[model samples]
Target: MKSSPSARSWIAAGVRHELLTRALPALRHDMAAPVSVIRMALLMLKRQVAAPTVDAAACEERVALIDNQVGELVLAIRSLRDWELATTDDGISRSALVGQCVMLMRSAFDLHGVSLEVDAALDPQEDEHRWPAGAALRYLFLGAMGYLHDGADEAGAIRIEADGANAVRLQAVKRDPGTSPSVLDAHRAPRALAIDAVALQSLADDLGYAVTLDGDSVRLVLATGN
Candidate 1:
């Protein structure tokens, strides 16, 4: 069994509470804030169960579920946190690389009970788009992500397919009869961002990339020639 402190580190440091709360709602049904506190307490209880050096058979599955839940939470929290702390001067060619975006989106996918696959083939020698320094890049992507998983149901799985040419597509398993892609698009678009969408759009315009939504899918296209 993983220790409680280790799990807490995984929760607070590893995942973004905002993304977890905003992106995925299905997972939150069982995760009450105070209940999470109790679960943390239970981790300690497991160690003292004595004789059962491990957990009881019935508790094994529940423990696994909790661990997975906590892990997903950790990833979501960390992705957004990293974005906030990242500087454009970091000097990496593709400022907000497609791969990094995919990794960041994984937490949201997990929350939606979705799986993600990436097939990026960026030219290693190529340095095309240079992202500007500040909160613009982070917020634009974060806002877009907020919509990607909004109100997504658990009928099937959401698949985010990104090709080598920088074509990113987000498809939920079954159409979210419960929500509209426009709502999410509006949230990610320049006009609707609570943060600085104008600057983000300007940077994206300079990079020759744009975010769009069609029906139940969201697409982000970046240019190799940018």
Candidate 2:
């Protein structure tokens, strides 16, 4: 398969289709957090409203809290909706793209007794670092995370790091002494909810990246100088 730009676009569409089909549960799961926050805020608002002495400031605060959570819910949903094209685009920041992937999968991670964390060694304001076909790498990270989630019989964390241009590393840190499937097994998501190996590799190749599984780490390394 050619790793040309058009070909990569088609691959990204395939991933988006798979996510919409297989990752629906996870997508729904991911929204639960913000919804829970809204619910709690509503409860507080009700109490504040019903209180004998209505504290206007407290009532306004609860309303603001609800509004913020609603905004988060909207952004969470739009992330999934926007990602079909976004994933194929180049020059996306490593941190921002990875954060969206984490947002889309965090609830699923919690369900499987795993935590997902991203650690970037770059200034959020100044980091202009990017790789070719950068956005689809979010699919790769999500796939690796799904791999970790599938293998966990105990609690664990997928510590993802973005360092040096064009590379992101996900290290599976088991909280206790336990085993996990290698990063290669990230394709083995139950119900086939993850990105498959062939498309994943093609995306990596188009991005000038190499995906490697070393012990507990899944690293995406891009070629130097573009």
Candidate 3:
């Protein structure tokens, strides 16, 4: 009558796969516009620079804007690559993963007037531990950022810290006392994030991690062994 632990685990993995099928596409869609804009801007900038009569000031402004947009595009692409690696069960360094996530969300945080910080506490010796790459971790990071972005007060800050030796703990805290305590919910997510909170939570559960919301922070504990 009751399902065994192994059976439940199997079911959970299946659910994660299904969620991924939906979530990945949504993520790609969210990223498409930015990528397109960057491509177009680059082409236009190239033509402008090639023109002999280009205005120096106008060229400088366009160059700056292109540089900024390119930076954002690079972050998004890195995050997408990481997610792909994770889905394929590839291995990536913990520091690299966290760094990518932070970079990927940095622009969004800046747009919302939220400060994002990352603290890497692991020793150099611990860098040998390779994290199991997958959408679960990516979802966890993005979901936390989404929650913080929505709930944080103006000029609020988010702190992302990696702690622990054998088992790594990744935490994101919305560091404003005025921030509203909010759990990420699919129904409440903005139209921009097509993936819902339930799918993100499901992926976390399937990956043997729990996303806990305490006050204004979302914490995910990851076991190195997987």
Top candidate (TM-score)? 2
Candidate 2 or 1, higher lDDT: 2
lDDT of 3 by residue, 59-145 (tens): 677778778877776776775555442357665565655665665666555544566776646323453767665455665556556
- Which is the better candidate, 1 or 3, if ranked by lDDT? 3
Model 1 clashing residue pairs (backbone): 14-74, 15-73, 15-74, 15-77, 16-76, 16-77
Model 1 bad stretches (over 4 Å): 1-96, 105-108, 120-130, 133-135, 152-155, 161-167, 175-209, 221-226
Q: After TM-score superposition, what is the CA distance of residue 163 in candidate 3 from its true location, in Å?
A: 2.7
Q: Which ranges of candidate 2 are over 4 A from the true structure?
A: 1-16, 19-78, 86-90, 120-127, 130-134, 151-155, 178-199, 202-209, 222-226
For lDDT, the strongest prediction is 2
CA error at residue 130 for candidate 2, angstroms: 4.6
- Model 2 over residues 74-186: C-alpha lDDT tens digits? 97787564445344565457666677677677766655556787774632546466655544555556655654555433437888787566677777777645444454236
Q: lDDT per residue, candidate 1, 86-190, as tens digits?
A: 444442323245445455566545544445544343433455545443233343354444454453443235555543444556565664566554543443424
Question: What is candidate 1's TM-score against the reference?
Answer: 0.37
Q: What TM-score would you give candidate 3 relative to the actual structure?
A: 0.50
**Cα-based TM-score, every candidate:** 0.37, 0.55, 0.50
Error of 2 at 48 (Å): 16
After superposing candidate 3 on the true structure, give the runs of residues whose Cα lies further than 4 Å from its correct spot.
Answer: 1-81, 85-87, 120-126, 152-155, 166-200, 224-226
